[model samples]
Target: MGMTRLLRQPFSHPALPSVSFASRTIIVTGANVGLGHAAAAHFVRLGATRVIATCRSESKCAATLAGIEEAAGRKGVVQVWELDYSSYASVQAFCARADAELDRLDAVVLNAGVATRIYEVAEEDESSLTVNVVSTTLLAALLLPVLRRSADRFSSENNLTVISSEVHQWAKFPERDEANIFGSMSDPKTKTMAERYPASKLLQVFAIREIAARTHDSTPFVTVNMVSPGLNKTSLTRSTKGLEAAVIKIVNALLAWEPDVGARTLVHGVVAGRASHGVLLDHCELENDALAPWIETDEGRRLQRKVWAELERKLEAIRPGCVAAMEGKEA
Candidate 1:
């Protein structure tokens, strides 16, 4: 993102194409508060027939749902669902319900994520990698069947987006061995708080490319893309403190986008056409999603391929038919 976008971003960006959600259903993950909550509310305000927001705790999400309802001044369409991206089981459970219940899914925003200053491990991987990279990727893969079903029935533009960040620009690939990269990530002593979040976002940039290309078929049924909200004022920095927090607040005041403004970038993705598939949208447009230094070299492509393959293997282990979901009915 450039300085112009930062300074001028508003609560409602008109760049998001006017579209109707009258008979469509959309899902926003991690929507209890902040960006996710704002996105969910935006969907409702835009007239979605149903908007399902995910939160780890149903009790806590009650307020969020109420807030969105209050903002929209409507009732009976917004619902809360449970999801904890740190746990694979939770991802599976959520997908199963979506597959069974949703008749025509219009869009899904994989917006649930964390940016921690400390190293916390979950499911044998660093928390950033576990939640932001692994779990998020897994959920996207698992949702394919339902998305495909939606496309078949609705013939409407279906979107699956990962809310990535401009911080990926800060990523420097860590370690050498592709096999050990995730294992190395498990060791908190090796990466700082600042480094870990960006690194995980970088991993998302890589994984989403693989997911998009492989899922795209002769006929484009779903548009799978990534969106970077630039710097936004959200719960992403809950772990920061003192001088660091103050500096961030000042920076945010000057340049960071407000939550509603940031959420528009995601809303844009839901309406994006096939040209946006398998690409990253920054400031609501497609641009090179990967770091030039890493993506421009032969060695970099090899490393990225290795990492993507590893993620596929892990996803297969969890959901045996995951990769096949991209293939549609054949799978």
Candidate 2:
């Protein structure tokens, strides 16, 4: 069956008028499920010319594609691409393929991530940092040209929206001993998996800010911003069982919103609107107070520089060509 025929429900928003994606091309990572899937479906439904629903496996993407097409009311509107964020080689390969297939990328939602799992290292010497932070940083660097191309074609509103989380508030500044993000996992005194997950998310916020700053002066039209989706029910939370689930249920009932509702901020960040470059948004609203204190800190800048340098070194080791492509080139 074709994909569009399967979608039956249209996304609803009482506050903001429904927006369409006609003629735009959006790349949604981890699009096989959860907020990624919802965002992909919403874009296709709004008339996006091309929606790349990227996932780690094609076989696993079938249901997502089907659901997206159904939601969009068209066949073949959503296309699946393989992207294993944990593998530097895979990330490079995906970029090469994306460059060939797409002349422009209107928006790239870096939505793929992991949580509540055992510590693991990606291809690069970095821990899961390679996957969650390094890979995302490199991908944006590589795709800036395409995003700029799209901005040239569109108005000044085109942007790159990064999916971040509120967990960023809890991240510790990168320390000498914690260079390897997973190093703490080995410590018996380490905090829970939930805490570690939030720390990684915090790194992403800094990465987004750095990328935004790097690109703003040159390509003001192509803004970059971070979006924090408040807690929602998704596969990432599947690890919650028994008492954990009960606690989550209670907490969610009090604070968490639906997946589509949570995705609103990301969607708003990408669409033409009042959003500013280098800003962090929460629930479709700019987070001035939340991000202001961190951005003003010397510690934040130091951590940003350290992480950026380390990621650059790791990427170069894994894919010299990609590093060379982004070197000295203004995104």
Candidate 3:
């Protein structure tokens, strides 16, 4: 994002319309706190029939639900489920439960993600890449049938939104040229944390664009989109320390939107019409321009297809038959 846009975000975004979600069932990952927590509460306050809030720990459920209910001034609508994006097994298990249990799944906000300056590995890859790109897309794929079924069954507009970031525009993504893009990303010897989070978000944009295009039909069923909630005051920077944390704090204080305000962008993504399909929703509207300029170039398109292929291969290795099953429904 440009300096002008970043500084204007907290001040210029207008109030979102109060749209009711009555009779809708929604899911939000990373709902224990931050934008996810606030978004879950907003769904409840808007009269959603149920909000399946997912966190990394079961122990956090009670307090998380309590806080959401308290914030909404409503209770019993939000239920916290356990999910660990670091584990493919956890992501699959959560989707399995959603498939088996929910009668009507209205929307899913894949908000669970991490931001770190450390070079830690999780699920056999760089931690941020695994959680933010691989597992997030995996969960989105695994939930496809459930969202489609809900649309077919209830004749409703069901959506799946992955929380993205405007920071993606800043990612140079030098690894895009590597023969094995993900392999290059996972290499600690070449990996750099300075742009890791932004690159991961860029990968998300690539994956979602491909997923949305592949899933598109004359009459679409489940609406799929990504949202950049703008810069928000969240614990996403909790891992940074000392001078880095201090700098971030100062920047956020000057520019970050309140979590609830930022989360309205997520809620807007869900309610956004089929027009939002295969696109980035920013500031509560379809934002094709928010994408990096290179994304429209020929090389960027090729890399997007490559990223989707690699991501599908990774998900299939983690859970056999999943990619094929999701593809079977595309046409």
Candidate 4:
């Protein structure tokens, strides 16, 4: 992006679908706070018939939903569901319920993410890798049936959007034959703490490419894309402490966009057309070069293939026919 465009990003129109969402259903993960909270409110205000807000716990959603309800007044309908990315079971349960209950699913925004400096591991993987990459990828694939069903039935371009970040540009490409990138990040000897969060986001962009490739021939109508909210004053930095937290607050005050403004980019990702499939939707425009440079060479293709192969195996083990359902377009 040029300096002029970057400077005006916060003011860019979200380019939300001109089409109405009156009868459409939307799902937003991690809706209790951050960009997801703002996005859920946007969808409600835009006339979506139902906005499913997936919170970590039921009690956590009261405030966010109340705010959204107030913003939409009599025009919004919101529902809260539990989704814990640390557990495979929680993801599966949410997907199953969505399939069984929702009549016409339209959009899904995978905005629930974490940026952690700590190397704590959960589900035997680094927390950032588990939540940002693995679990996010798993949920996207599992939810494909519902998204595709909506596209076919409504003849509308329903989207599955994964929230990524500009920080993804900061990661170094993985070397050939590196088995587990997450494990490498957990090792201080091999990892730089500063780059760990970006590395996880890099996986999200790659995963979006891989999925777009997989479903391209089979399910071409449902748009799948990645979006960046730029930097926003959100809970993503709550884990920082003392000097670090103080520095982040200062940076946010000076450089970060408001959560509601950033949320517009998330909405653009949800309604973008098929031309945006497999690409980064930066500043609400389809970007061809926002992906890693390696993706342009044979090495990047090998890397994407290898990483996605492993992800497929891992997610399939937990959800049984989940990955296959993506190809078959079953609901």
Candidate 5:
């Protein structure tokens, strides 16, 4: 039984499909390093007409393009776009650029995220909450219209995948009971450094579920889903130190897959088809039941709705009418 459980956990190289991405456009966030870098190169090698690799710094562009060239053994198909997830303005601006510049958008992998041991804040919330939950979902809401338009123009369902993790299953989420959940999360008194990353991922699961539910009956559909690539050896833990980092280093050596190997699951997710709508994909397989058991309960469902309403208000503040725009409704 122990061996069975261990094997069931996602590890080893995930299979990549033989399908062509020719004439398709893909956007990968944080593509200058780690899994995002590997996935962007995979898209290029797989024949995508345009692969936009977004990073936080402009200085990273040339190096990122060079890395992609070396990995894909190809150049010119990839463009490095500056996108700072720390700023809502940057998120909005990136979407606007995509709207004006791209003829079509086939898929987006929301792979940019952080794992920090510090209690830093950005955009009025905790840094992880801001980047992984708010700005990430805000970007998703704003880009829905673009994805919808692409769906209609190309007569295909475009994918928008949030890179999630199994750690969410372990998140105690002490803030779930608060009337203003996000507000509670923003308070330093409620902060737990060890649990912050997992909680952020849990919030992402909740937000993505709400987005999927709202868009379920809408027209010109885009397939919205969350994916867990499992643990991979990446620089995501570069910020950690001391015993935590030491433990992580040991565990990574024992179980983590390489970024390029883990990246195949990310590529599989973007083209997972309409059936993947509003669900979690684990190891390139559907795993709706794998969501935290609490998420399916009555209280959990209520919290999900509450979070959705609150998040829409937050998104409205960031980009007026974006929530409504996401649902294909007039603001």
Candidate 6:
């Protein structure tokens, strides 16, 4: 099928007949608001059997769940799962619960992330590397067994789609300094939030490729792809100040699509026509030549491997049993 045809098939819009999800299950992280919430609601409307809308707090997730249920005319079909991406224990706990309760997870939307106002270290010296990189990496690793089991139980084709950003093009990898990455910076030029945010996202793209490379030989049906939503008016962008906010607001008003529109590309990445096992996509299609430089770089790959190694060390320190458990299961 053509790319456009595949991308448009799963989501036809509210006026059209919703897609059937009689047996499919989906998990969307950070579903409490913004893109995650929109994606979860869309999945529910499409008739997904179960849509796990995960958030760090149950109370914060209430409104999102209520709105989705109201729109879908169902209650139990859409449930809440508490997941704090910053905490390794929380990530493990959520994965364990999912393994026990859910029959299978057809799709996992790795959408949760943090764009901090200031550089802050996590449990380790990992700042952006921790929340954006390590947390996501560990979550995917922890859930891989369940994802594989689900793929086996449910047909064969399963999907893992991570939400990356177009801004990743501006950052340099491999040369990142852990001290500067999470260090205290008083200078505006040295501590720009956009730079840090994009760097973390770049890491995610490489991680996606690494994951695809590792899994492709054994699991051809489990497609791993990265999705860039473009610039949408989500909570992530709501805090911009001065001319920056004004410029973004105007641009978003003129060209920025809705959260649902942005999410269309992500959903398509998961269920669309054949996507390259390790490709990075923007707005439902592979990014053009202009965006290729950011994703394809020896430096990027080196940085990704380094980040993975550092993450493994940190996880081994905090969650001693997790790495061993995941390795044994995948073995």
Report the number of clashing residue pairs per model: 0, 8, 0, 0, 0, 0
User: What is the per-residue lDDT of model 4 for residues 1-331, given as tens digits with 9 covering 90 to 100?
Assistant: 3345456655664554344678879999998877888888888887888999888876786776787777656434998889989877888899989999988888899999888787767686777878888899989988887888877888777889999886687776453356776566656576565667878887777788999888887653678888876777799988888898998898678667777878888888877778888888777778545666777689778777877887777787787778878875553
Better of 1 and 2 by TM-score: 1
Greater-lDDT candidate between 2 and 4: 4
- Descending-TM-score candidate ranking: 3, 5, 1, 4, 2, 6
Candidates 3 and 4: which is better by TM-score?
3
* Local distance difference test scores for all models: 0.80, 0.68, 0.87, 0.79, 0.87, 0.69
TM-score for all models, in order of appearance: 0.92, 0.84, 0.96, 0.91, 0.96, 0.83
Against the hidden true structure, what lDDT does model 4 obtain? 0.79
Residue-wise C-alpha lDDT for candidate 2, range 13-40, written one tens digit per residue: 3144278777888999998878888888
Better of 4 and 5 by TM-score: 5
State residue 13's C-alpha deviation in candidate 2, in Å: 7.3
Candidate 5 clash pair list: none
Q: Alpha-carbon error at 189 in model 5, in Å?
A: 2.8
Worst 10 residues of 2 by lDDT: 1-10
Candidate 3 lDDT over 190-225, as tens digits, reads 997889999999999998888888778623377889
Mark the regions of model 1 whose C-alpha exceeds 4 Å error after superposition. 1-17, 176-178, 218-220, 287-293, 329-331
lDDT of 5 at 287: 53
Tell me how far candidate 5 lies from the true structure as C-alpha RMSD in angstroms. Answer: 1.9
Candidate 5 wrongly placed segments (more than 4 Å): 1-12
Off by over 4 Å in 2: 1-17, 125-127, 153-157, 173-194, 272-275, 321-331
Error of 5 at 70 (Å): 1.2
Candidate 3 accuracy as lDDT: 0.87
